[model samples]
Structure formats: C-alpha cells, structure tokens
Target: MELWFTEEHTKDVRFTIRVDEQIESVQSDFQKIDVFQTPEFGKVLVIDGYIMLTEKDEFVYHEMITHVPMSVNPNIKKILVIGAGDGGTVRELTRYNTVERIDMVEIDKMVVDVCVDHIPQTACKLSHEKVNLYFEDGLKFVKTKENEYDLIIVDSTDPVGPGMELFTVDFYENCFKALKEDGILVNQHESPYYAREAAAMQRAHEKIKKVFPVAKVYQAHIPTYGSGHWLFGFASKKYDPINHMDEEAWNKLLIKTKYYNSALHKGAFALPNYVLEMLEQNI
Candidate 1:
C-alpha cells in the first residue's frame, strides 16, 4: 500500500505528498509535531497538520529570511530568533563570522529534538558554540529584553494556536523595543494568495509599518508552503533592505547560497501589483 499525507491549505484546496515512512509523531504541550520521509521533499516537518519545512526546499525559506537582512546590514552582531525550532535560521546565521551571539527561543523543545534527530540538514547547527537555546515563550522573552539584540527573526508558525500573539500589534511593539536603534526585524509574513492567509499577511504588514521607521515585504517561492508564494516582513529602525543593502559588501563575503542572490535581493521586494494593492488596503 502507498502512504500519502494531505494538508488542507484552504476549505477547497488541499496539498498531498507521497510519504515513504512516518518517522516520528508526538503531541507536544503546544501542538502536534510529525516527521516524515518522502522522495520528493526528503525529510518533512509538520506542525498542527501544516507543512513547516522539507529538506529539499528548506534552503529557500531559511536563506531568504536570514541573508536578506544580513546583507542589508552586515554590521549585525547579536541576533534573536523566535519560534524557529528546526535550527535552519541559526544554521545560516552561523555562517556569518561577524555575528557575535545567537539566542534562539523556541517554545517547543520537541520540535527541536525531533528535527535534530530526523532532519539534520536543517537542525545540525543547534549546538553551535555561539548559539544559546532557550525553551520559553517568545512573546514573554521579548518583553524582558529591551534594546538588546541587533536583529530579531520571528520564524514563527502561522497566526494561530501559540503563534497568534506573535502577529499582534503589542508583540510587534515589543519586538521594536527589543532591538537597538540600528536593529532589524524579519518575520515569517504569510502568503498573499489565499484569502485567509492574505488577511493575516496584510494585518502583520500594517502593524509592523506602524511601529517601525521602515517596513517592507519580500517574496520567496517555497513549494511546500501554502500557495507556494511566501512573503517575509522586513522592518528596521535605520536600514532599508533595498536602499541600504551593501551588495558589494555581501558579495565580498562570498557566501554561497542556493536560493538568495544579490540580484534576487532587489527583485524580491518588487511585489506584484495585486499584493501591493492588498497591502495598501486600510485594514
């Protein structure tokens, strides 16, 4: 018999993948986590029946989220990652030798453990010397921190379950306060294709725009995510992802990437007219 896993991307749309085996399944304190082996995507990680990352296409999301902001402001040193338990974000950050400290606050320890055991491609750098892992609520963690980190990457799940608060205005306000004057905040801005996801994406963009001096959205093509077109929020106190981006400096580092390149960096911010109109709506 063939094994297949399906997720409801919308009430009418569904995504299915052929699975080789169910490697692990566990009910954590927050949500259900599952790991699967598949031929097309390699190791797949799912949370609450939503696809998070797959080994084959994971580089797109991870590199786009990390390198975009890093390239814009190469002086970034201290970093905080909220809710990225798979360690993919930190894995990319470790490649930057100029980065001094990396603090990852993931509420679900099981996600980290399972990913490290089953998906080492994305989780291999969790134990890096510069990384300090904290198993705590990211919302509360940012509250205690004020003007501490140079960058904060909100690598959260969708705006539901435990991640609901991360999308609120209060949380974005706290994130703004947690960063230095020159700090940057990059978040998992949901896709703009589906209705439900688009609303959340617009709301997040509006909130961040209100709080930060500079707020913009960028797109990436990740086949596993809903609608396959994903957006990431780039907000900063001083830097503009496009105008301030030091393409020459970033190229000088010779950082090899699979999905993100300096040329694409400028192109990603050129949002589609529909997406731009959606973002422009006064919600």
Candidate 2:
C-alpha cells in the first residue's frame, strides 16, 4: 500500500502528493496540523487538510504577498500581519530595515509551534525581536485597533473554519479603520480557476471595494496551491499599487526575492479577460 496526502480543491477536484514519510502530525486547538517529507516538494505543511506551503514553492507565495505592497510603499514603518502562522510573511518583511515594528496576530499557537519545529525554513522568523506574536482571533484583534499600522497583510487560510470571519465585510471594515490614511491591506484572495474558489474571490473583491478607495486583484502561480493560479487582493486608502510604486527606491534597498521583482510587480495586476469579467460581476 502507498501512503499519499490528498486535498480536495473542490467537490470534483483533488490534488495528491506522494509522501516519503509523515514527519509530524498534531491536533491543535483550532485545526489539524501535519508535516510531510516528500521527494518532490521536500517539506510540506498542511493545515486542516489544506496545503499551506511546501519547501519547493513557498517562496512564490511569500515573496509576492510581501514585496508587492512593500515595493509600492517602501517607507512603511509599521505593519500588522494577520494569520500567517508559518512566519514566511514576517521573514520577508524583516528584510526592510525601514520596517520598525511588526505585530503578527495568529489565532492558533500550535500552528506556529509546529511550523517552527517541522518547517523552520518558513517559520524561522517567528521569534525575531521586531515581531510581537498575539495568539488570538484576528477578527477581534483588528476591531480594537484604529489608525495604527502603515501596512496590513491578511495572510489568512481559506475562508473556512477559524478563517471564515476574516473574509467578512465587518472584518474588512475593521481593517480599513486599523490602517493609517495611506495604509495598504493585501490578502490571499482565492483562485479564479475553480467555481467554488472563484465565487469566494469575487465576494472578497466586492466587499473590499466597498471599504477601500482603491481595490485591485493580483495573481501569482504557486504549484502546490489550487489550480496553480492564486490571487491576492490589494486594497488601499489612497495609493494605487502601480501608480504609487517606488521602483527606484525599492531597487536601491537591494532586497533579494525569488519570485517578485519590479517588472513582475507591474505585470501581476494585469488580469486575464475571464478573471476580469468575474471580478466585475457586481462591482
């Protein structure tokens, strides 16, 4: 018998990966966490039966999510990251010396601990002196903050289970209030290739547009994720991701990234006609 890990991307779609061995598995207070070592993707992290990241392609997701907003506004000093328990997002943010503080709010502590133990490649920065970890519900965390952060990254999981609330209009409204006048909020906006995820993506974009003055969608290809085509939401109070981008200034920092660059930054927002059509459904 062969042991494999499978994730249902939808009712009719499933992605499976061959597993060399199950490294670790734990039932956290919030969800089930598992780590597997594979010949193809190296170390893989799975949360609640959903693929979170893999050693092979995690860079694509992390870099695009962090560097896009940073390149657009390089002077951002304070950032609030909600739900990136793997610490990959914080690791990328810490590369900027201009970033003075990072407040990371994660709903589960076990996810962080497990990632720290089994997936240190991405979890290594969880204890950086600049990062303050808060193990609490992100929805409730943002509700108490107002005009406090220069950048807010909602690196949440799918809009299900504990993450369901993070996708609501109320949460986006609270995020709008939590950001400074020029703050930017970037989140993992699900894929558009599948109808199930596409519907969620459309709903997210529609709700965000209602709260932010400028809301746009960007794309990146991650092999382990659903359909290998992932979308991210960029919402800002005043700046347009492309028009306000400081390419010259960002390049001067000499930050090294595997999947994000000045050229890719501008091109990521060019959505296909089908994706554009879906995004324009109600907006």
lDDT of 1 by residue, 150-259 (tens): 99999999999989999998999999999999999999999999999999999999999999999999999999998999999999999999999999999999999999
lDDT of 2 by residue, 128-151 (tens): 999999999999999999999999
TM of each candidate vs. truth: 0.99, 0.98
Off by over 4 Å in 2: none
- Compared with the true structure, all predictions reach lDDT values of 0.95, 0.94
Worst 10 residues of 1 by lDDT: 115-124
Task: Give the range where candidate 2 is weakest over 10 consecutive residues by summed lDDT.
Answer: 1-10
What candidate 1 gets wrong by more than 4 Å, as runs, is none
Q: Which candidate number would show the highest lDDT if scored against the true structure?
A: 1
Cα deviation of 148, candidate 1, in Å: 0.9
